[model samples]
Target chain A: MLQTPPARPGMREDEVDTPALLIDLDAFEANLDTMTAHLAGTGAKLRAHAKTHKSAVVAHQQIARGAVGQCVQKVAEAEALAWGGVADILVSNQVVGADKLARLAALARITNIAVCADDAGQVAAIEAAARDAGIRLSVLVEIDVGMGRCGVAPGADAVALAHVIAASPHLRFGGLQAYHGRAQHLRRLEERHFAIGAAADSARRTVEMLRQQGLDCPIVGGAGTGTFELEAGSGVYTEIQAGSYCFMDADYARNLGASGKPVAMFRHALFVLSTVISAVRPGIAVLDAGHKAVAIDSGMPLVWQRPDIRYVGASDEHGKLEVPSEAEAPKVGEKLRLVPGHCDPTVDRFDWYVGVRNGRVECLWPIAARGGFY
Target chain B: MLQTPPARPGMREDEVDTPALLIDLDAFEANLDTMTAHLAGTGAKLRAHAKTHKSAVVAHQQIARGAVGQCVQKVAEAEALAWGGVADILVSNQVVGADKLARLAALARITNIAVCADDAGQVAAIEAAARDAGIRLSVLVEIDVGMGRCGVAPGADAVALAHVIAASPHLRFGGLQAYHGRAQHLRRLEERHFAIGAAADSARRTVEMLRQQGLDCPIVGGAGTGTFELEAGSGVYTEIQAGSYCFMDADYARNLGASGKPVAMFRHALFVLSTVISAVRPGIAVLDAGHKAVAIDSGMPLVWQRPDIRYVGASDEHGKLEVPSEAEAPKVGEKLRLVPGHCDPTVDRFDWYVGVRNGRVECLWPIAARGGFY
Candidate 1:
């Protein structure tokens, strides 16, 4: 029942399957090269965040473009990337539970693995797991850099956690995990700049305090697609960990560039290929991509090539499109490309990305990290 | 690195693993029986929605309980259910492209299958695929029953489409699909009653016209967890498609019952098992389940069993729980259950379901339909 590739391989846009997750190889490579060229000759290293792509194929590409390593939030993501031959990985968050810790420790045997901690209990858990696995684990003291999320307070408290990490024979002090997560999506460029500035100061202070304690800080990681340039330019952040730059989402599109135009780091590559299923009314149509196909946590999906048609609402399987009276309404069998508001969670909704080039599905890539939340 | 089962099968709640999808077997079974028993002699059939469970295992269980078959929104989902041995499936949504339509028609070779449509072009495409495959595909003319998303207009427009479905050599007019989708979550009991009332009116009108056109509608499907009782009691809706009842979510819990209490057809058995990774300050703890683990489109995740702690905000990997001064603050590495606001998409985020009885993983079920979005 499965149809052949939509268009012949290497053909242009008309042959890709509907409801496929697409990544424009041309735009994706440019985004990577742009990030690479932006930080060219700079001391800051790019540890491309795999949480965004969740594909080892993409991860290998990022590595090939001179990314230091990859940063992931879960053990499963690290495992998938590692199995794909990614040698260096940072869990970048606390690893709790005996089961998850054991998985994290096991990854170290295969790759250059590091994890972050904000508590002595978590550090002890990592130490116990590393000891049991007969491996040394790298630990970073996560400093609260104005995100008000996960991380201990900067300065003395951060240094104290670093001491706990350094005290363990099974663990080494990798550095301060200073990430201003909230700064990435501040909307206003100035707001993001100030937020990162404050975060850099906290990280700088934490590094000085760790130095005073005779500890060497190696990896100070943080930054996302929205504000990696600011963090990279700050000269304080050692590793710029931007994940979504390769497949920029609608939310990221809201960020103002230096010229105040939309910063075109990446083209709109990732899209929910939806089909117009119902043209029951005069100036209205409903698409097949709804809450199940696309995540709307940020906002509704943008209808590609049809600015006149606005995606007004969604049910689990149907998205209502508000069509313009003057324009021709979409036909029932017509296809539409949807740019998701938030790409990370939206990508989690699909199993395979129908990799299309020109118009045909050249390949089908399983999102190896699609449901690797555990 | 994958750990052994947290607790043996049939263990009690206390022995269950932290952060697991727990289904109260007793309550779950009761829900299934209750639906079937309620519609026992009413001539209506239960085609349990598989998008809720996304498990072939659950689909088989439903089939065992006299369910006419299963309904899915995606072609991949239908394929999974069919492969899992589900004999009858109604895609319940339109399939647009040749690739998807071919997959849909292919299902008919394996099982009794049908799909809904509201447009001529889509019907043409379906007919084309079915003709090419040498298969007769059942087609349901979806009428707009107050849900303005996907459906043809109620009266003549619906009858016309049904006629088209009946006339096509490769397509048979299955029935009228008058699903009042939005009425499922009207919040107020009276509001839902009135909403369903309007929908029933539209459906009744559509049925009357179909009778005039000599088309006896067979499957009048639609109805969800929030308003299934109304549809079942109406004698008009022949199929009650309630998926979330098997895994009741927080949004359904907010529904007001006839007696003014929360609708209690099903219990809140599903939860995101998260651990407190950072206990910064006395009353604030950070959890591992954030936007990635639990969706927040409906609302932020509610703290399960801990009324004093509020899940304030979420980043990609971390959830912030605001502990009230009166609450007992949890320690770092402590596990807590979070009740997600919405169930359908939230369930889509995880790959494995850590089934807990007491405090142990009694069973581990892969979400077979986890990424079956296409």
Candidate 2:
């Protein structure tokens, strides 16, 4: 169910309910403009990943600022974007079951929809669903590029899968999906450069192999917030699908730059706005937000702008904060912004993004694809 | 938004969509019956935590089998239950803000509603909301037994908060809320025995203090799936708040029995039914379910009934499995059941529960409070 919106348009940030997803509009728009400036002449277009924001509002904002389209991971996300009038979307991950493919195919009529395939059986399944929907769906061959979770092997294996996609009755060969997800969080600049370099080598080899078969690759999509600049400079990747760049998190903020310092490419725009609901002792305080309201898979959330305070632990609905002293303890009903360790899954936990600018709620955008994980 | 139901009643279990929440109805019902039998002659009533299942259907089942009421961690959960005909409900955690307190007070008009307080300021806020709503709200003093997340100290502090609740015109002192959350996962039976022993001693001392202050605890609530037997056997707790007993997860399954084996008190009735989306080579495969679909806070989910395959890593939309060899590889489009690491947050990620019995889907229960983390 869609949750009640946590804030009204003109309410102060503190008046907004606890455990709300907050976006600092100043930092958020700066991040988007920063990305636009960075990609101004890179010869690579931005296809912002919707799996991070999950909102068609955010997708449209990116598109208005020069993003080519949006990329999603689930068919349900594709549906939400299509329903919200996103002109083009790519399911950057595989759509496995017939039920999911049918849902994907139905959206092809409303928007330019594409999906990835790593197996011939899946290509056939996509074809069948497209045929059932009486629509020709664009299918991309995902090649393994260090991120071993999904995708076929890069050179010959990828070309063979592309052939299967081209031979399908109701499918169009959309190109290659080579995303090195592990390379995104590599702490060292040299380490990230090396990983993306190898990923680009694999993609370049596969493109050459596809050309040998008289096939022209229309799109070669990959890159993330941490390594978009590297992929853009590689002169190979056509689309930079960087999602977290627009909402920098603590995990992404940890990525180092060429100077061996934490990268400041993007500002931390996302926060879990939580209230100090309990303060039993001097140095200990508890926030209303927990792992249920914020993501903890990367690490525990950090107390925003308060180096003296640390989020020590999380239960279902409580975030324990360790303060410096009793004299400076957070009072009950005090609101604090928490920098979530991960931005993607934290956004998944919320239904509304309380867009705040200058300490006031400016808008409430529905997290349209919040629970559409299927 | 509520998601489309993954399966219809009468459909085969395998025919359901990938990454769907499945409940083995036979196992689920047996779990309910087992809990009923455990507390049958113990004089302790079950008030199963709705934070685990988040379904009114499941709560109704528990109540029909002699559960006194249901407990939730948030006002949104209490609202979901009250609207769904749960006559008696308790907000087992502290509700901090005025907005949340107003929502909770509004629900009191429909059902028997109560909330918890650990701070004097919070008690005053609840009294104001109750006064505004023209209702006498029941407020429980949450005492810290062992869990350091929330609640005041056990004896004097708890009695003082209860006094504040009793002094308020629009609020009534409900009882004592002393839940030991961490003790629920103590692996060894003896460790669990020791932890709950301390917890029960504290609760007993507090109850005595309240009685000496001319107060009575109508509900001395504490205990979970791991230590409910100890709390019930303590002869002091009137309510057992065991939520995961009806839908056991992998973490709870790790609790040891008296003979040093995994306890077999409750069956594993919950599963994240996921499809193998990609299986490129031997020893590695990927599923459609990840931490976003099924939680990984406690640990990575275990492959149900598949001792050979292990879930190793999870990205946003993919769960990577480490299998043995190509001879027994998980094929693309093959369905697999995964035992989630935690049940509460896993249940929070979905909007519907596909209940299956005898290999067919028997019902579809709406996870009505799915995104109601407020």
Candidate 3:
């Protein structure tokens, strides 16, 4: 069940409930425009990932700009987007099991849907599900471009999987899903450049091998907010799947640009707006938000614009802030903004996003896919 | 919005969707019975914390086994439990903000509810909200019993806040909330004994101080699954708020007993049922469940009953498992059970709990407070 919306439009930002997910509308729109600007000269198009925002509203905004479609990590997310009137959807990750594959195939009748595959057995399962649903399904062969989490090895193994997918009666070989997840967070510009360069080389070689086998690759998708520019400029990548650029998190902001500084391309539009509930001890205060409200897997969240106060620890429902002194500690009932260490899971914690502009609540968007992990 | 339940009754556990929250009914009921048997000689009653299970179904089961009430951390969780026919509820954490306080006060019309407070301003806010709602609300003084997250100092500070609650026209001094959360997970028996011994001393002194001031300390609530035995026998804490005892996690299983081994008082009844989506690498496989499915905040989830496989890394939607070798690797589409590092937040990730008995789903219970973080 969905929790009640924390705030109504036209309310002051402080009037929103504590631990509510808040988005600065100006910064959000600017980040969207910034991603559009960065992808202009490059031939690669944007397929903004819905996993980070997890809302049809945000996905529609991205598609209204230049994003060709949306990339989701789960079949349930694809369902949310399709029901929300989005025309194109792609499951950028492999889906196993008959129940999930059937759900993925069912979506093909409503919208253009595709899923990635790494194993021949999984391709066969997808083919059976497509045939059962009486719909042709697109299957992309995901290749390991240095992440080493999912996907097959680059050239030969990838071609083998592609051939199996293409050979299926109800399945079509869409292209390659060459995502380098580990390279996205490399701090230095050269580190990211080197990692994406190697990833790009693997993708290029695999594409050439498939071409030599008389197979045409339709879409070559990879990259995230951290390394999107690198892949976009690589010329081999046709679609860039950068999700966090629309609402940057503290972790991705640590990535360095050419000048050895944090890349200022995307503004921090997302925040976990929390209130100081307890400040009984000197130099210490507790907020209503914790890891349950804002994720700490990436790291403890940074207190927005308050370098003097540090969120030192997080329990399930309490965030402890280590302050300078009693005089400097945030008072009880004071609202503060926190930049989450990770954006995707943090967004998954809330039911609504309170869009704020000029210190007032502008809109409330339902996070329709908050628990769509099925 | 709530997502559909992953399975129907009478279906095999293996037939349920991947990334489903599974409750082993046999183990879960045995855990409840074990807790009840242990608390038979102790005077302290069970006010099972709903923050872990977050379901009225589980709460009713515990209440049927003689639990005094249910404990929740947020007002929204209390709303969920109260609406689900729970009569007595307590918000075991500080709640700030007028919006949340008003909602908490409104619940008194339907259920007997109380909330914890540590600050004078928060107490005043609650008094105002109760007055507006035309209901006399019970307010508890929370003491800092060494968790150092919420709560004020134990003796005079706690008594002073109790006096404020008693003095309010629309509030009553309910009790003392002295929960030493950090003591719950101490590895060694002596370490837990030492920590909880001091915490009990603090609660005792605070209760005596409140008695001297002519204010009766009604319910002294604290303790979790790890240290409930210590608090139950402490002769100070009248109510034990142990939630995870009915559904133990791996972290609680690590607590040491006097025998110098794991306490082993409870069984791991909860699991995140996941499927291996990719196994292309030599000795590595990826599961569809990641941190988004199973929480990794306490630590990475343990591969249930499979010591040969280690869940080494987690992304947004992919869990990377390090297998021993290719021959021993878990094959693609293999459904594996994972014991989450933490149970509460992991339960927050799912909408339904697939209750399995004899390896078949017996019931589907809605996680009524799945996103009740408001």
Candidate 4:
């Protein structure tokens, strides 16, 4: 019942129509290469977070580019990647419910699967599910570095969880998941450096504590698109889990690098192709991409290639563009590309991503991990 | 394959599971009855906005409750309602491309379909589509009623469009669409009153101008969940188009009535059922519902029925809740519901709305119009 997959593969961009999800393949490939080259000789492996791409095609491309594996935040997302033939995956988060845990255990039958646990109860749940399924589950102990959001306390508490994981017959102690979710978008270079510095120290201490307890850390993972360099440079973090680098968003454009320039690791590959529906005022025009078409969590959508036009407001069915003084407003029937403030949630809004290269439709990738909330 | 439907026809709240859409049938009915009662003696009619519900099931309910027709913002939305057996539909916005306009005109073969036009080009396009389909398409002249978003000029410009509509034998004049979208979110009653007052003045002037040329508006539709009362009371707006009354969200709570109290016309029923996936800290817990489950375009989601616990921040896979120092944090596997900031966009995030009434799985309804981005 998908009316017509937004932009089918091999179709031209103009032929694909309006209000479609467009991904610049060249920009996307460049992003993949940039991340791969940066993490080339670094001992840390790149398990590019699939929760960002949510497409098997993208995962396959990343793997071909030399990523060690893929990391997913949900069991359903893992199922998508695994079904797409991703050989290795880490369910970078915990699976709680019996039905979902059973589903996770089933995935191990097909791929090298790993998951994390911050609590003893979750460890026991994973162990029981694995035992019943007659499969060994690779379980990591998540340690809270400084995000204060998810993970066990970074020192002795993390060791205790690691012990619980090792003691389980059906579970093997993986490593530490010390992720500072807040540091990814710290804006200033010094702020991100300080945040990652504290996070690296916390993770180093946790790994050291585990070693003292005779536990070998196999996979110390934690990093995002914003701070992968910081985590990869740290000797303790063996795995870099950056997701949004493939399609950098406006929020990421706010981050500053060491040399004080805005970090430009990735190009703006994703955009919402919208059509001008109404021209109400001299300097105000409304487009079809609105709250439903794009995600505005980080901020309003940026008018791609149109610095003079500002996407000032949005309703359910309309996006209001504020025309700069002395600038000609967009006429009705014109098409515009809107770069979303946040890329992850914005991708979830559409059912398909129209891959456009050189102004022609190259491919249409389904948002397979869409609605993997359960 | 479709995992599940958006909602169920006959199910109680508890049986549906957590984070499902709960339609308070009583409140829903009351809202419809109130609208019907308000427009009973008045010559004006009700064209309930379908952009809010995006479901033909709800559209049918509104039609059964004395509504003359249903109005949707997009052709895809209109098609879903029309396919669901709604006889009369007004696409309250313009359709741009040939594919979409053709789709709009094709619906006329199955139902009484109309659309609004703010420009001559759009009017000509609609006329061409109607002629091609051999159908008489009703066209509304959208006037800039102070919402600087969409519409033609209020005076001669609108009258000129009406004449354009009159010129086409296959097209009929169908009044003015003068929706002030910003006025819907105005927190103060007086502000909304002033906004709608200006809108009504513009519509009235347009109607008078049309009358000078022997044209009478058959309909004047515009109003939203927030400012429906203002437009309904304006004496000029013939049709009250409120959509969110069926599923109120956190944004509507910010709206105040004339008495300065939070508008209590409808109860909050829509929510994202999320599970406590991680308890990383003693006074903090992370839920599975994050940016993907709930939208933050208007603002962050509120913890349903739990004022003490704050939804402090959100990531793609997690919503961080700050538990009160004295309060017990949620354990892993516990479920909580989040009241979304904006229901329409939040609902668009899900493929299905698990409709639960009392308890036990009763029935499921597919979001037939889900991903209708066009």
Ranking by DockQ: 3, 2, 4, 1
lDDT of 4 by residue, A252-302 (tens): 998988888998778999999999888866778889988788877788899
lDDT for model 4, please: 0.83
Q: What is the TM-score (0 to 1) of candidate 3?
A: 0.98
Alpha-carbon TM-score of each model against the true structure = 0.94, 0.98, 0.98, 0.96
- Alpha carbon lDDT at B199, candidate 3: 98
lDDT of each: 0.81, 0.92, 0.92, 0.83
Evaluate every candidate with DockQ and list the scores: 0.49, 0.79, 0.81, 0.60
Candidate 3 ranges with C-alpha deviation above 4 Å: none
RMSD to truth, every model? 2.7, 1.3, 1.3, 2.1
Q: Model 2 lDDT vs. the true structure?
A: 0.92
lDDT per residue, candidate 2, A36-67, as tens digits? Answer: 99998999999999999999999999999999
Model 4 chain A poorest 10 in a row by lDDT: A1-10
In the range B1-374, model 3's lDDT, one tens digit per residue, is 68899899999988898889999999999999999998888999999999999999999999999999999999989999999999999999988888888899999999999999998988999999999999999999999889978888999888888999999999999999999999999999999999999999999999999999999989999999999999999999999999998889988888899999999889999999999989887888899998888889889999999977899999999999998753377889889999999999999989999999998999999999987878
Report the lDDT of model 4 for residue A198: 92
| Displacement of the residue B336 alpha carbon in candidate 4, Å | 1.8
